[model samples]
Target: MDDTAIDYAAVFQALPGMVALLTPGLVFADANTEFLKAARRTRDQVVGRYLFDVFPDNPNDPGASGMRNLAASLTRVAATGERDAMALQRYDVENPDRPGEWEERYWSPVNAPVFGPEGKVRLLVHRVEEVTELIRARGGPTGGRTRVLEAELYTRARELQELNERLRRAHAREREVALALQEAMLPACRQVGHHRVAVRYRPAVGALNVCGDWYDLVDLVGGNRIGVSVGDVVGHGLAAAGVMGQLRSALSAASRVAMGPGEALNILGRYASVVDGAESATAVTTFIDFDDHTISYSSAGHPPPVLVHPDGRTEFLDQATDPPLDACPDPIPRPQAMTDFAEGATLVLYTDGLVERRGEDIDAGLARLADSLARHREEDPESLADAVLLELLPPGGATDDTALVIVRL
Candidate 1:
């Protein structure tokens, strides 16, 4: 048989594992049926697209290393003309039927460089074997292994278990550090002027819950005016916390020189647009005037502030609000809503995490908050804040960070 007569394309297509040929520039040259099945993509969808553009990292999870590791491996293979095998990686794939939805997948990959007749790297061969099910099974026990392979399987399982344990410990340590950093950045709840203030911050239950929920109280230049704010940034981890700190500091500074709540929020919205890595944030800022016995507040896509009257009647100050900071290209004027606060009345400000749940409607959460506030209307500000958190969040923990602020006249 002539070697030139062999159908290389047929042989490549018959391979069981996922395989793709990439050009020197990393464009998809050819992909086998297995590769198409694993990627959930057609030849037309991926053939001409850049590798990263076709399969980018998960936007919501900044810690995902699949794209980074794959890129590095390809670059190394191109430079050294050698095969590179990578460890297991969590590479999420987008659902073809549902836009913006991702499905979790784990893969072990190997990259080998294909050389041209000129002795230069021309094409790259990439192969992947999915092991997501095997990994999930290894966490528990498995049955029906032959005695000959039992020892080998047991050793491999033990190694995987140890790796998972180490990852868990590392995540725990990271959570601890992030919590401490968030705590150090947040402002302490204390009295401002004659108004009594109390604040509560509860981070989410798991290791990944450390986020950018923040509340702050700022004393304006005038003794009779105080500024209060609560905000939730878009993502989690140190990046979100850092953006929260920057926005908090900017809001505080703006409160000192700016006229009122609307002006402060306008400044914050403008600043958020220029800041790097800031996608968007929701915030509510209020200007409390003791001399006037009134509260003026503005919201940037945040939940409405709740007010409890001296008679225990509760009202949500829902008003026409602008979009969240950094959410849009053009800036819109933030409108301030004014309402009178009677003596002994209380006001509550909180992030969406205080009210939002996985399957529950947000309106229901807000209604529950109002009910909780009305029930604890007679308590002091400190006690009222504590009661609300205890009632809503309970003991175990919430799925997202919760920040609450209560002010009593």
Candidate 2:
């Protein structure tokens, strides 16, 4: 069967057992048919409502522990990102037919965590099997047969708990591998010439901890010059990361011996034409020559680097720009530009993630970056990097990977 064509909503409603979806805040998101039937609730009645609000503790049962026990179990799942298989509990539900009356019920419930990309509990899968009939047949809740059923249910719950633990471990391992791959591909920050360099990389908040965005710094042959570049591949995760590694390495190697940033990018563009998944990738490279007091730069459809003077003036280096990698029908020389910078001026190189936001023009994002850089012009490279990220990214973090490099010249 074509999975994409399958009707997931239909499948969910048709599932054999009672199942419900809850947000981390314990608000009902959805409920399957069996769940609605078991609770005598309509979809409209439960969805978007808080669990406790819909099924408050039985008012007549002065010692009702149902809500307390179930709340504790759900809280555990949310806090720990683990499953909590609750023992059979006596939770009474209001009789829909008789408004003020309550119907005694026993339920075997299990709450499991559903993790988002950041490995946080995004939702809870609440599954339950009502055993009111079984308990009643076994001579009420305190009967010997009821105790035996509880024991059997507990054993099954333990098995389910073990399975959940294994799934969690596997998820953790995948995250570790993604992080290790990212660390391995990206280099450590270091000082180049008299300037302090700071680098930052944040993967998108998702199951994968890596993306196509990358940054590099190469201390050129002469101690007075250093080459720094930032590039973004077209995708995320391992496939994009693999392409990023290849493109970054090519640029680094070319920058070492190429005559200028434009020449290095031309070489990289040619290489990109042959590398799979490199099409439409964008990059910007800058060579800071301390001795000459000049900054030479080039862009392959990437955003211009920002230059912040000591006196709080900001300039965007957009003079030299070109289409993204392999956008040209044939190999051609890329454009380069040179500008002078005074001592203590700071240069910022970053991927689009630092400025791009949903539903906003890129110019707005660039303006925000320029304003932030001007405000923090005097800060050191590390402080400026931190400030830029704090000001530009959303409160929850960016939706895409961001690779940033800051150099104080």
Candidate 3:
């Protein structure tokens, strides 16, 4: 053989899955065509560059361990002058065409050190077998005992899938039941004395979980005074809805005999603490005196009501705030706040879900609500309520259940 004149680069490039020669300083000395193809790069882009700079870890993925694991394997191979084999790794790579997008990949890597005449490590030979397809086809790692384990895993996975489908159907049925219960308990929009009332109830977007948000309007004391209540029970699903039903019934019974908003909330709070799983509920109760043309209200850690005037003025009723119901075993008297009720004024009461958004301060949400109300202040009660919802929670915007009541007196 003409050993002195032989082209060793041709042999290195030809024999490979994906192979790269790294210098002692972890700089890429050379890489095969297969390595460049897998990296979505060219020879000019990869050669003579630091390995990490050429192929950095995916920044968006916090669990990306490819660079760290490969570096450790190379270091071990260089220090001990022995081969280092790594297990399957979830290595994400950035798309060359799409910036900030990562493609998921798996690799089985082996690092072996090359020695110089002095018996010191000179270059590290890194080889990677792209086993992403193989692992996915086998549904897991495959080896000597994997065939038997894979069969068992396949059987268990099918059984689990069937079990999950059954559970999903059961949850759907429960959600339907809860929705029916909620709809039956909710009062329809109607005229209460001289005022026109409108109500809206929307379930949270996505999923079959039913939440515990409700609104009510009841005539108080000889049908002259009216009581409006909006409450949200903590959590969701069947348990929360059941608690909401209990609270609604208790509040209705208490409002009949209670003197005002403060007394009504105080009674409802005491009743809520006794009900199972109802301790963390929050509410707002308001009483309207038609004869006196006045409005008195109280809150139990709930969002304050927004009062919109006929002439396009708006104000949030933030005073007389108290802790959520059942926050204390023996609750204190909820103080009441009163304001003049103009003939054409509209009062808006709602659950927090109507205004709250993820990653935003509640104050911002309130400001948005106020702006929406001021924009639609001239519309009728039903149209105004609908407009506010469309503005705050457009399609696919709500993450929690929402209940809203609008009263135009």
Candidate 4:
């Protein structure tokens, strides 16, 4: 009991490790400064407290009693004078100061009893280590291990970014190639009997990579008459865009000699039918011929053009004379039908991509397109046509390319 003996009191009070000398009862007898710091308590608060009273419950526990086990281990060690060890995996303990976060802790314990002159166990020396840092080090990579893992992660992230960039570039290149092919195949404005006319063509959204819709307007007869054609090739990307160009050119050449819609489409279809690459080629075309006050058109497996009378009446023209060109040799479109274009009549030609949507049936899409065109017929032909296109197709409705042209008489 003297202060000068081995200063067991001073030794226990100053040890760096979490040191606590307990009685055989597993009750706190005396603890070191380090133990108090780890416990976040002072001797006045911890002395005489049972070990199980302060031991926290396990979070990943099976509802087994860990607190009681620790007390039993303490009693067993004190009785046997043997050393023991146990691991605390992520024992949930909150920093009283920073309650927002919890800490991970691990413990290594050993309790040994000292003997007195009477030869019975006199004092139980309980030593503990706050192996928090050691456990964290074990959980994470170290030195070269950390570097190797970091290198692998960095490499994986870089590969992902590189793949993303490559995909974007590929998409852009596809669009450029499709557009360039369409532009190259398009014929310059020509006279269809005597009018200086031009054409309009638009590709669908991602279909820029493979535009399927196309149009051609010609001023035949040296600017005396006008001829127009619209078509959809059964594909996307380069193949569709290429077919559109071929048809537009074929129409330009055929219309010079034959100004009738049925004849022009027939001529083009025969040429396509005899061509090789059947698996990769098929097209539907609608041709229209317009003079001073008359209009005639023929369809070949393509959507019919819409004609709006000056009196606000609308006509949907989908009755085709033949199946899509290229299905067989010498597909003949029926005789073209003639209609009078009074002062206010306007003809609208477009591909289905302009009027169709994913979840909608063909009838609904067609009806909506007709309704939209009627609402905007009072505007200039170009404005009316553009308005109708935007309304029916909206920004994303047509996944493929679209082409539209409006003629006012």
With a 3 Å backbone cut-off (N, CA, C), the pairs that clash in candidate 3 are none
* lDDT (tens digit, per residue) of candidate 2 on 7-71: 99999999999999999889999999999998999999999999999998899999999999999
Worst 10 residues of 3 by lDDT: 135-144
After best superposition, candidate 3 residue 245: deviation in angstroms? Answer: 1.1
Instruction: Point out where model 1 deviates above 4 Å.
Output: 1-151, 191-194, 207-209, 394-396
lDDT score, candidate 2: 0.89
Best-performing candidate as measured by TM-score: 2
lDDT by candidate, in order shown: 0.83, 0.89, 0.83, 0.64
State in Å the error of residue 295, model 4: 1.5
lDDT of 1 by residue, 3-92 (tens): 899999999988999999998788999999999987889999989889989999989788999999999989988997866766667899
Candidate 2 has its poorest 10 consecutive residues by lDDT at 186-195
lDDT of 4 by residue, 1-409 (tens): 6657676667657777887877787778778899888878777867898765555555455554555556766777667655544333234455656754546555555556777798777777777655455435454556545544544455466546645765787788776776678657765544343342324566555556446566676655543456777777766777666666666678678876775777776787777665433232333333333435766677766777777876667887655445676765545454567666676667777777776778878788778877877778778765776677667766555676677777665
lDDT tens digits by residue: candidate 3, 302-363? 99999888887888887888998899798888898999878888899999998898898999
TM-score of model number 1: 0.61
Measured with C-alpha atoms, the lDDT of residue 161 in candidate 1 is 65
